[model samples]
Target: MSHKNKKISSTPKHTIIKALEKAGGRPKAVTEAADTGSDSEDNSSPENLLTPKDVIAIVTKTIQSELRSIVSELRSEISELGSRTDVVENQLDVVSKHQQTTDTEIADLRAEFSTFKDQLEDLENRNRRNNIWIKNVPESISAEALPDYLEGLFLQMLPDLSKESLNLDRAHRALRPKPNPDQPPRDIIIRFHFFKTKERIMASARNAQSISYSGSHLQLYQDLAQSTLKKRRDLINVTKVLRNHSIKYKWGFPFQLIVSKDGRSHSVRTPEQGLDLLRRLHLIQDSDPSTSASPSQQKTSAPTPSWQKM
Candidate 1:
């Protein structure tokens, strides 16, 4: 017999005998009877030692053990799968909350951006109504010079008017004045950025009745009016007429301009006082009659107009 076959033949017989003995039985009797039915020519065959039933019983027990082990391993794998499922659910909840928070923050930023855009548009519209004027002045008149003159002169006209004056070497200017006899006066033009100051300039025009500015020095007031909306409109009617006239005035340093025949001398209000002479002749008109009258009557009984302050 081959070695491998012999070992296989002995394996079933040995397993059956061991199981039968443990049960208090003889595996040899069953094996010997089983071999007689198998029609074995050799009576010394190894199959005579055991029966098939005994072998089958041993294999059934072994199979049951293996099944139990497989069942236990399957239970352990199921438990691990349940734990993994819980972890996945927790991670999903966290991701969902984070996405909601991110969405809310994005919405807030969009609202803020909209508000900022509206404010920017409003500022741009307001700037359109404001204007600036400048004149190419002589080198002698330093940048600091005109600002001082404007501060002193305007302060006298409107003591309550709060304003800041500046004379930048390169101030922004616009050409909106009508063409006058001088074409474009190249002295200097001051500017006001805020539109509200325009009302103050208009008020100055109406209150300059007591002043007289020489024709040669008229550019100073004209430049001021052009810098603001309210004053520009008030001056438009006059500018149109003066632009058509062709007349030049003499110019010199100290300018030797007569501010008022009333003999009131002060740099604080010289320009306004001079404008009063040209525009509001009513101030000088009433004065001449009273002075021309008898000196005794003027002092004793002359009544003052409501326009003049005591």
Candidate 2:
């Protein structure tokens, strides 16, 4: 009962056999049967009966030999794999460097394309520099009489300008379907032979704030390229913020929003510049999308005048 309660050893079979040879009992009979097998002899001939220690030693040596062979094969495979990994790492580094060079070239091409696009837009705007857009003129005036009508309107705006000097190269309604009488009249685009005349009329009209012809109020705008118009349109939010702050703004040549403060001018060239200016002035709370701040934080921000300042 006491022997049954004792823990069995977890050591190798050789340790158990050694212990049994020292203890003379039923274990001796068991050992005798186990040691007599063909595979049990350690170096001794098969004709002689083998002892328990000899059998256990023979089995241990066989297992150790198998383990050594497996270990040798595994080591060889591991060494080969290490060499292959080094080559792969070198190849990956070359690929990484090539990717970096390709990325740099792509960036250079994109920059050149951007420069080309801006130059093209600038050329388009310069071509129409002497042109002006007159809106809300009544359709009652025929195309033949548009030239005379515009002359009269310009005289009304600038009473001092001589009639002979208002040399309008061309004046006509926009080339589109005429709006219904109830709808507002299509805009009239006029190209003056001289940019100076156009500039004077535009300046006078701006100072007057509004122009009226045949009792109907008219609006004046520059005949800008579609691209220039889009650039201005994209700044609508920025301009809206400036307007809300009571900041007066005006457009400059080559596309600039001019703002004056303390008799000094600051200009905003792009929408991002407008935003940064507003942020710098603390006109709006930080509304970075990366921030945890909610939607209510993004509503307000405020803009600009100068050829170069800011």
TM agreement with the true structure for every prediction: 0.31, 0.73
What is the clash count for each candidate, in the order shown? 13, 5
Q: Candidate 1 lDDT, tens digit per residue, 3-57? A: 2233333444465555655644444455466554674444344544445676567
Each candidate's root-mean-square deviation in Å? 28.5, 11.5
**Once superposed on the true structure, which residue ranges of model 2 sit more than 4 Å away at CA?**
1-47, 279-310
lDDT of each: 0.45, 0.73
Off by over 4 Å in 1: 1-50, 124-310
Please give the lDDT score for candidate 1.
Answer: 0.45
lDDT of 2 by residue, 62-110 (tens): 5686568557766777888887887887887777777767877987998
Cα distance off (Å), candidate 2, residue 194: 1.1
